[model samples]
Target chain A: MFELILTLVLLVIGFVFGQIAEKRHFRSIIQREAETRDLLCFNERRIPQDMFSPHVTLVCGSVVVSVDFFKHFVATLRNLVGGRVSAYESLLERARREAVLRMKAQALAQGATSVWNVRVETSSIHQGQRQGIGAVEVMAYGTALVPR
Target chain B: MIVTNIEYIPGKKITQHLGMVSGNTVRAKHVGRDLMAGLKNIVGGELKGYTELLTESREEAVRRMVAQAEAIGANAVLNVRFSTSSVAAGAAELFAYGTAVVAE
Candidate 1:
């Protein structure tokens, strides 16, 4: 009975705090993305003949996001049903957008006008004793072209 | 040395291709970070410690890759790629690879 109560308490705490954090993070991401729209980004390797810049450097951004206890529980139930685990989807979406935003921030710091050949990689990292909780790491990288 | 993920650097010609070069590293954070991460798991937020770890490991991997390219007399590495995998319970491995090339 004690274990069950503790679990329920943890779930309630997770649900409340996770929702608040997610909402705040999404608001920030959307605002920053709009501000960063001028920084051109492309996954294509080719650059137009007139678009070449003299200085090139590699830039990267990475983020690690963990799932809340309540979402983790929901995902566990989802696994048993063999269907889409929506709880985790929002987690990954937030992570990817944050990673990209960080990458853009880095590029802007370097005085780069554009990023080319952008790539994103995501991995599931183990969190030691708490294997029940899911943590994902997302990394965004590209070459930033700085005009002379 | 010039490094870019694209297959070729714009406005430059590749004089030679020195095959493939790669570097890899496995890293684990201290117990304190793990404890903090566990606590952060409840509220569901960014793990800044893990992000720093990944950045450091990636820089190390890229440094080793650049060293390999230099040893092979390549002035640049093109088509660079990065990958990560959890090699252990608390350790992650970062790998970087690219084609070593001489460009003019």
Candidate 2:
């Protein structure tokens, strides 16, 4: 009975540590900061905002995916374990959603109401040093429009 | 290797397909300092890397696509388009496409 309890405790601790480690790694991978040159407007005492054209080229964002990643890692595991792959699904979906959000922000900053002719793409990337190979990337982009 | 943007330009042939390209790679870094800037963007801060990569890759891929166009007896490419895929972590594929055309 003691041995069984100890084993269970160890498993819980290990799982917790794994969650902590994975969270850090995932956050690092999902970099959601903006760039200066991509800027349209901001409040600052120094530089006059009018100097730079408020017209910003909006972008929804991009992603690199490996179907095998979902298949082998998440999907396969879910199939074998009979559980949901919510964590993995959220990563992929968030990337797409966040990208579009950024574009919307850019448009808003530039006084644009809507974007036009948006383009979204998914492409395969088979770059592994050896043996196992599979991955995919999705990129979303669109033009920002400003009224004259 | 084909571009949708080039379509707006007249006298260019639009290729519906992207040309075959290999080793067309793009690398971006979120250096510690860069991350600070990005975090700043959270509350009226500046985000980094996204635009630069977009502009850089677009130009590079377009250049490559243009070379392919020249090889195929085309004068200008129209309706240029851009795409990116991660072939590996730390390495991304940048593809540009446009219609290859000789002046009609």
- Candidate number achieving the greatest TM-score relative to the actual structure: 1
TM-score of structure candidate 1: 0.95
Per-residue CA lDDT of model 2 for A1-148, tens digit only, reads: 9988765655454345434544553564455333323434221212233332223243445543222222334454587878777744654554454455555565667666445556656554444544323333455655444545
Give the Å error, residue A128, model 2. Answer: 4.9
Interface RMSD of 1: 1.5
Off by over 4 Å in 1: A127-133
Per-residue lDDT tens digits for candidate 1, residues B1-104, read 99888888877889999999999999999988888888988888888898999999999999999999999999999999999998886689999999999999
Model 1, residue pairs in steric clash: none
**Prediction 1: B-chain TM-score:** 0.98
Name the 10 consecutive residues with the lowest summed lDDT in model 1 chain A: A126-135
**Fnat per predicted structure, each in turn:** 0.79, 0.07
Tell me the tens digit of each residue's lDDT in model 1 across A82-136. 9898999899999999999999999999999999989999988984544533699
lDDT of 2 by residue, B1-104 (tens): 22223133222234443344222447554555334433322221112344455446655666677777777766555444576765554355676655565543
